[model samples]
Target: MNKKQISILGCGWLGFPLAKHLISKGYKIKGSSTTVSKKLMLAEAGIQPYIFKLGEDNNQEIYDNFLSESEVIVINFPPRRIPDIINIYQEQIRSILPHIKNYQKVIFVSSTSVYQNTNDWVTETIDNKPEKDSGKAVLAVENLLKSHSKENLTVLRLAGLIGYDRVPGRFLANKKEVANGQAPINVIHQDDCIGLIDAILKHNSWGEIINGCADNHPLREEFYTLAAKKANLTPPEFKKSETIQFKKISNTKSKALLNYNYKYPDPLILVR
Candidate 1:
């Protein structure tokens, strides 16, 4: 049997580590980076490096070479924060649609931000009414991909990423009177992020939307404060607020379909 050939677009924080993990599992990796300097790093880590910036790199040949013969494509880049981002982000993904083979499967790295603050638990079936511009961009791209080729795509909506270098302790450390203290946080560790994706590939789970989040939702104040103290940083202070807005992301679909077991099932586990 032939080994799987996986192409990862935007091999920065999460994609870079994901490529390494997949390589260890005996998958051949073709990874992309906007920075030409990172070519050596990716190659050393066993990734076939392709250097090009989406939207700016108009060379179709580079994209073709990067995507050629790969069975799975992981679209892992986040939409840039800017005015008129909905159009811009949509265009970026749209540009690649023509290049993707009809048989190839895509795993789009979406975010929980696609769901608005309903102060209740949300699943894949909930209608997306995103609150922020970034969320709007991501949702637009999700729609674009689905409309383009719904059958070969799987959207993995992740919560706030924490683990390894992404220490929750540094976020709002020594901050005074931060807002949304009472709101419950939806977060997942980087390890679980990789694990969830692996499970999706292993099970050949496609043509679905899945949420990848920890099992437990911790109050923002509780998790961040404990995280800061664990790192020996000054804990942030949160103001008392009666108005709390939050959306607890549900991972039931992922668990049932992919048989995924979150390595860090609780946000507090990272701190404790």
Candidate 2:
């Protein structure tokens, strides 16, 4: 049996790590970066790096080649702050969809922000009423891929990603008066992010939306304070305020269906 070729769009941060892991697992990786400088790094990591700018000129041929050659495609691009980011994403999807016709699988990396802040528990069955601009745009792209793609599509709605050098303690190391200290914080480590994708691919799971978040939700103040203490910094203060509309995200579907276990189940465990 031949190894599968995987193409990762927007190979930065999470995408780059995913591509690297896939390569190490004996899959051929073709990754895209808008910046030309990143090509060298991708090449060094044994990835066939392609320079693909979403809105740039004369780049359709490159994207088409990538889409046609890869057996699986992962779209991990973030929306830019254009006046009509949703429309732009739609256009990009339309452009790429044609080339990915023969691909066996497609993974759309989406955000948990697609859920409206409702101060309740949210699951895959909940109607996605995105409250933020970026969330709305992500939801639009997800719908476009789900409705139009002929291939099996898997949508992974990830919580705030944290790993590598991007730990939360640095975010609040010296800050004071952080809002909503008592509000529960939801996050997933990058290792688990890649692990979830690995599980989905290994099982050939598709045509489903899975919430890719850790099982734990700690009060913001407690997590941040512990993070501060670990980093040898003073814990920031939190003032009690009116609760913003937010919900505890449910990962039951991901757990049941994929049989996936999160490596970092607790938010505070990462700091300790």
Candidate 3:
């Protein structure tokens, strides 16, 4: 079978590695970055790189050329957290939506933050009531894609990404007082995240909202204490709170829908 050409928008942390992995498997990958420096970086990794920005002033001709030869397009940028940023994000992505019509698949890298802390298990079926700026931005973008893509979008709401240089222990290593220590953490290893994306493309599973997370939900205190210890950092102290605002994110849907198992099922083991 001939490999499908994929265009990756915002080829940063996760997207860059995914592009490289796909390339090794005989897929032709075209990646884009906002910085000119990344052009050489992507090219060095065998990706055809393009530099462009999304917004009302976007150059249609440039985006058309970038999206022209691609069978798949991955929208992999994190939503802006600043206030009044959703409109900007919407403009950016919606501007590119016109050019993605010919693509067979459109995968949007989203976040579990879109789901509010309901003190219960959250799934794709639950209504999204985002509680923060970042969550609001992501949820808004997800809606835009869902409404305009004619059901051709795949939204992967990934958990707290813990891998490579982004280990969780270092997050609260020197922190004095941390809130929500008893809250359950929904985190996924970077390796499993990439694996799930690969599985989705292989299975041709589009038109779905999937929660890309791990099977285990450990308490924040226990998980972070260990993560800090492993990194040889000062462990954080959790207040003695009687109330626990916690939610355990279930990966049952991702496992069932994608037929995938997480390599980092136990986050406590990540402390090592």
Taking all chains together, each candidate's TM-score versus the true structure is 0.97, 0.93, 0.96
lDDT of 3 at 271: 84
lDDT of 3: 0.87
Specify the highest-TM-score model's number: 1
lDDT for position 263 in model 3: 95
What is the alpha-carbon lDDT for the whole of candidate 2? 0.84
Query: Ten residues in a row with the worst lDDT in model 1?
Result: 53-62
Model 1 segments more than 4 A misplaced: none
Model 2: CA > 4 A from native? 81-83
TM accuracy, model 2:
0.93
User: What's the best-to-worst order under TM-score?
Assistant: 1, 3, 2
On lDDT, the leading prediction is 1
Evaluate all candidate structures by whole-model CA lDDT and list the values in order: 0.91, 0.84, 0.87
Q: What's the lDDT for residue 156 in model 1?
A: 96
